[model samples]
Target chain A: MTPRLAWRLLPPLAVAALLVAAWQAWVTLAAVPAYIVPSPRLVAHTLVADRALLAASLGITLGVALQALAVALVVGVLVAIAFAQSRWIEASFYPYAVLLQVTPIVAIAPLVIIWVKDTHVALVLCAAVVALFPVIANTTLGLRSVDPGLRDLFRLNRATRWQTLTRLAIPSALPYFFGGLRVATGLALIGAVVAEFVAGTGGQGAGLAYQILMAGIQLNVPRLFAALVLIAAAGVVLFSCASLLAWLALRHWHESELPPR
Target chain B: MSAAPVLAVDAVGHTFPSGTTALTGVSLAIADGEFVALLGPSGCGKTTLLSLLAGLAAPTAGSIAWWGEPLPPPGRPFGYVFQAPTLMPWARVAANVRLPLELRGSDRATAQRAALAALARVGLAEFADAWPRELSGGMRMRASIARALVASPLLLLLDEPFAALDEFARNRLDDELSHWWRDAGFTAVFVTHSIQEAVFLATRVVVMAARPGRVIADLAIDAPFPRGPAWRASPAFATLCADISRRVAAAAERAA
Candidate 1:
């Protein structure tokens, strides 16, 4: 990596190391029971020892989040475009969209699980619902935020509605859309975990949330800590993926992505 | 002046929904190949008039004819340069210049060629790949002009396109615009609050008054083609400027 990138990575890694060291020192000095607060070494040991079970669970949770995010991106953007096509349509549906967002996922997840027999699909649907609003809201604002002069230029050229949206509005909406996507990705992960907890599916295809739930009941604190660690890691990785995509798509002209002049 | 005018605005009037009158009894017939400047102070409805001429809005009273047809929804293939450069920040200069043709359903290759040619005309061919932010303010304005000229428009409308630039950049653009008009022989209606810019570029200056803008004086420059720095430094230029300045001051008095 370049020196600039090295600088960025080093500071975060150093802080993490310091936190781990502090945690271990406290655990050793206080002689705390591992069930109450596992030492950093014990958590690391449990992470390796339970790798197979934890890895499978991690795969399921992350898979659900990713699928939900993908579904949300497609549906949300199309909905936002439809909103742009007519103010009447936007006025009618926008409030319900806000309602979907404002209602907590846990409140609705149980109802969704009961209604949809296929638990996995229901989980994905629940996660997608939570992730959908930002893309729609941000993209709608971006579509409306067109420069007035540019709008006139399009009108002057007699651009068709399709031409205006694809050539002008879509490109204009991208930075804002990516911004929404970043937020949506994190929400998708949180929603996925929440839905899995509510679903309580435990047999062969149990997710990390199920593992975390079981570990807490069994009081296998290190295993619970391991599952929590995997979730945190997954959230960071997913968030970074979104950031990288935003930078790649927008580095050419977007102010947020552009190098300083 | 030509026997048949390109644009005829006959006793046009406009009132916003809020009941502010923007234009009143505004009649103008712009002949083919004439560079007309709409000179007035702020709130004089110069922009509203231009928007109307372009069929961006319909007048509340009266009518307009473009190339002998009743105003708009019939394609006249005109270009408009807004007060701001208004290039799409996301697009390269070439793509931005090609926008009109692309909107007209021209094939990509043809539009790209026309874009490059237009950029060459505006001395921006080399900068066609640059983003709008990569360009200086004057260069960005040049790209805006190239976009306007790319499709070989019949009429060009400018709304104080250079007003934001420094004096040097503004004068340079004015110089290039004058040359482009001379060589291409297209109809142009330029809107500006600057008396000097109006005097320097327009074949005829249509001085307008505020408190519901109406034409105050229409004076033809009667100067030869391709006026340059020599013309600008001459006593003739100063005389014309002084005359136009007096009319503009009278407009400010009326508005007050």
Candidate 2:
């Protein structure tokens, strides 16, 4: 990285470090009760002690979320292409998609569990639905929003519809697709956890949500804080991965990925 | 002169769905290898006529034909450049130039070679991998031209391609474009508001009246090819510009 960009990044890094240090100091200085507010050191100890359990739960959550996200990416993009092809299809189906987006996933998770009759499948379906809309909306908008002049230029070249869609529309939609994916990555995680929360864990094993609930019930505040930290870390990892994918896909040509110099 | 016309615009007219008429009973014919300029005031249907000729839009009345074959399917017979560079922002300069070839199912290697050749023609080969955002306005326009030229279409339609450029860039591009057209041997229909530009680039200038656009005058420049700055300062060049300017002013007055 250039010195300027490195320098610019320092302030945020320093602030985050300061916040962590302050949190550690405050928790230690107060001699807070573990149930009320576990110290960072205690949380760390709980994490190491319950390493096996935490790793298993994290594996389960990650597996479910990634499966749902994969499904959403495929189905959402296909549906978006279908919508882009025909105004009538867009008119008929887009509102239902909006309906799905607006409807609360928490309210629907139990219903999905009951309907699907398989815990893992139900969880994946609910998470997929939660993560699917942004991809559809963004990709569709990108596909249809091409410059008329460019479209004309393509037409004048005798480009087939498929060629136009694949060569022009899809590439044009990529940034938007990645934009949706970034949003959906976080949503997929939340949906997986919430589905597990509502559906009472099954399939492979319990997830982080179950651990949190169990820790809360047992009044193991250190474990609870540890689970919470794991969840936050998982979220950060998901966001970073999604952001990295976006940067990789767009960095060479797109303005969004231009590196500071 | 003895053979069939390369392009024929037969009593073409256009009225938007909003019920505003842009052209009325406009007609013209262009020979093969001709460079024709559609010159007029703003809103005089010069672009409308070019669009009709390019098959971007069908004339509400009358027909346009190419070499006795009706204009191919609204988009196949010609290449077009809009007033704006209109390069896709997401693509690199090479990718932008390769668009038409890629659309036509050219393989990556073939497309890359063609894009490189076209970019070299326009002196932008070095910036091929750079994104559109990185290019200056003139370089972007050159890329647009390279794209239009890459397909090797019979007809080239330019809608004020240099209207937005600085005077230096515009004049330089005009000289370059004239040379390219002479060498490429393609029929060109350029639209512009500048009388001097029309005189400088075109063999024939078709001046139009405003609102419900109609041809008011057609003047032949009769200038030699590869016109340089010296030609711009020549007495004959000024006479042609002044004559076209007078006709354009008269057309504007009649519309008012």
Candidate 3:
């Protein structure tokens, strides 16, 4: 790795190592029971022992989160475009969209589980619901933020509706869309875990949340800590991916992605 | 000169939606190949008149005709340069210049050639790939001018385009604009508050006054072309500038 990259990463790693060392020291010094709060060494041992089961559950959970995000991105943009096309349509429908967004996903997940036959599909649908609003809101605002002078220029040249939307509105909305993507990535994972908790599915179609639930019942505290670490890592990875996507798309022109002078 | 009237504004007046009167009884018949400057102080409806001529807006009281037809005759395009560069912040300089041709659905190869030629004309040939934010204020305005002239429209309208630039940039652009006008021989209407600038470029200076804007004088500028800094420094140039300045001051006083 380059010296710059190593230097940039140093502080965060330093902080995490200090925290882990303190946790290990406290558990050993206090003689705390493993079931109550597992030591760092015990949690690491559990993670290695339960690798196959945890990895399978993690794969399932991540698949659901990623798929839900994709669905939200595509559907949200289309809805935003429809809203952009007409104020009347937006006026009529936007309130309902906001209503859907504000309603707690956890409160709604049980109903979603009951309504859908397949538990996995229900989980994806619930996650998509939770992640949809940011995309719609940001993209709609960006579409409406077109410069008046640019609009006049387009009109003077007799640009068609499609041409204006594709050339002007879409390109303008990209920065905002990527911003929405970052928020939605985290929300999608939260939605998936909540929906799984509500459904309480186990055995063959189990996710990380199910593993956590099972470990909690059995008082397998080290295993539970291992599962929590996996979830946190997954969240961080997903967020990083969204940021990378945004940087790749906007680095050349956008103000946000340019290196600070 | 009684040449064909390229654009005729017959007693035009405008009141904006905000209930502010911008123009009153503004009538003019611009002849072919004339470089007319709408010289006035701000709020004199110089820009309002230019917008009407560009067909961006309609007059509330009267009509404007293009080539003896209604304003903005379809398929007959005109060039327009706004005060701001107005380049898409995301696009490269060449893409911004190429926009008009691309909007009209010209093919890729042809549009590329024309865009390069236009960039070269504005002395920005090498900066074609650079972003707008990379360029200085003067260069951005030059890119805007290049975009305006890229399609080679028959009538060009510029609304105080160099107002925000430094004096040196302003003077340099003014000289370049005079050369472009002389070479192209297009009907041009330039709006400005600077009396020296109006006298420097226009074949005729149409002086106006504010507070419900109206024309007060039409002075013919019979100065020789190929004007440079030497010409601007001459007594003849100073006399013309002084004459127009007095007329503008008198007109402002009359309006008050």
Candidate 4:
């Protein structure tokens, strides 16, 4: 990174460090009980001690989140393309997409878990449902937002339907699709954890939410905090991956991805 | 210029579905390689007439024929430049220029070469890989013109393509466009609201009035090729401009 970027990032890092120091100091000074609120040191110690267990659970959760994200992206983009192709289809089906969006995933998770039978599959479905809306909404808007003059130019050139869709509609929709991907990644993580909480699935294939639940029930506040941190880190990693994909696809030409000139 | 006309507009008229009469019984005959300027006020249907000539839309009344046939069957026969440079922002200049050829099923290498050649013609060869947002307004317009010319169109239709540019840029582009039209030997129908531009560039100026737009005067400019600053300052140029201006003003007044 450049010196300017390092300098820009320093303030946030410093503030977070200061906040952690204050938390540690307060815990030590107040003689706070571990079951109530663990010190930063205790939480760090617990994180190291429980690394194998937490890491296994994190792998399971991350797997679910990634699978959910993949499904959401593919299904959402296909649905958006369908909507773009026909007004009749869009009018008939768009209401159901909106319905899915407005319905709370927590309320829907129980039904999904019951119907799917397999806990991992249920968790993926729940997360996918939560992540799908942004992709459909943004991609649909982008596909329909082609410049009118460009559309006319295409018509004048006698472009076939396939040509118009592939050349014009798809390229136009890319930035919006990437925007949706960034949003969907975070939502997928949330959805995965929430689905795990609802299912109460545990043991060898248990996700991080199960570890968190077990830690809380046993009053192991330090381990709970450690699991929370891992979940937050996973969310950040997913977001960064999406952003990197977007930048790689659009850095050369797209307005949203262009560097300052 | 010739007895056998390339295209004929026989009392063509257009009425929008909104009940607005954009053009009414307008007629003109364009010969091969003639640069005809359609000069009129806003809402005078000059653009509508150009669209008709390009076969972008059919005339609601009367007929427009290309080479005495029905608009010469829809393929890449003509190029049109709009008032704004309507380039796809996602594509590089070369890709944008190659769009017409790509749509018509040209191989990638052939289209790329043709696109580069077109860009070179418009002096944008070096910037072929540059994005549209990276180009200046005048450069973007040049790229747009390059895109239009990539197919080596027989008839070029321009609807006030340089109206958004500054005076110096407009003048320079006008000169360049005239030269390109001359070298390519293509029939051009230019639509503009600028009297000076019409006077400077056209072989003949067709003046129209608003409110059911129709031609009021068709004046032949007998000036020779390669018109310059000297021609713009010439007595003949002044006389022709004044005469056309007077007629346009009179038409506007009569409409009002």
Candidate 2, A1-261: lDDT as tens digits = 989668967997899788878888988898767789887778899999999998899888888899999999999999999999999999999999999999999999888999997788999999999999998999999888777887888777777988889878888888888999989999999988898899878445799888888888999888888888888888888988999899888987777887866
Clashing pairs in 2: none
Candidates 1 and 2 compared by TM-score, better number: 1
Local distance difference test, candidate 1:
0.92
Query: Which interface RMSD values do the candidates have, in the order shown?
Result: 0.7, 1.9, 1.1, 1.5
**In candidate 1, which residue ranges exceed 4 Å CA deviation?**
B1-3, B73-75
By DockQ, the better pick of 3 and 4 is 4
Shift in Å, residue A130, candidate 1: 1.1
Candidate 1: Cα lDDT at B35: 98
lDDT per residue as tens, model 4, A1-261:
998669857997899899999999999999999988899898889889999999999999999999999999999999999999999999999999999999999999999998997889999999999999999999999899898788878988988999999989998889999999999999999999999999988998899999999999998888999999999989988998999899899987787877677
DockQ of each: 0.89, 0.66, 0.69, 0.70
Please give, for every candidate in the order listed, the TM-score of chain B alone compared with the true chain B: 0.96, 0.96, 0.96, 0.96
Which segments of model 3 are wrong by more than 4 Å?
A: A1-7, B1-4
Q: What are the RMSDs of all candidates, in order?
A: 1.4, 2.2, 2.0, 2.1
lDDT (Cα, 0-100) at B139 in candidate 2: 95
Cα deviation of B221, candidate 4, in Å: 1.6
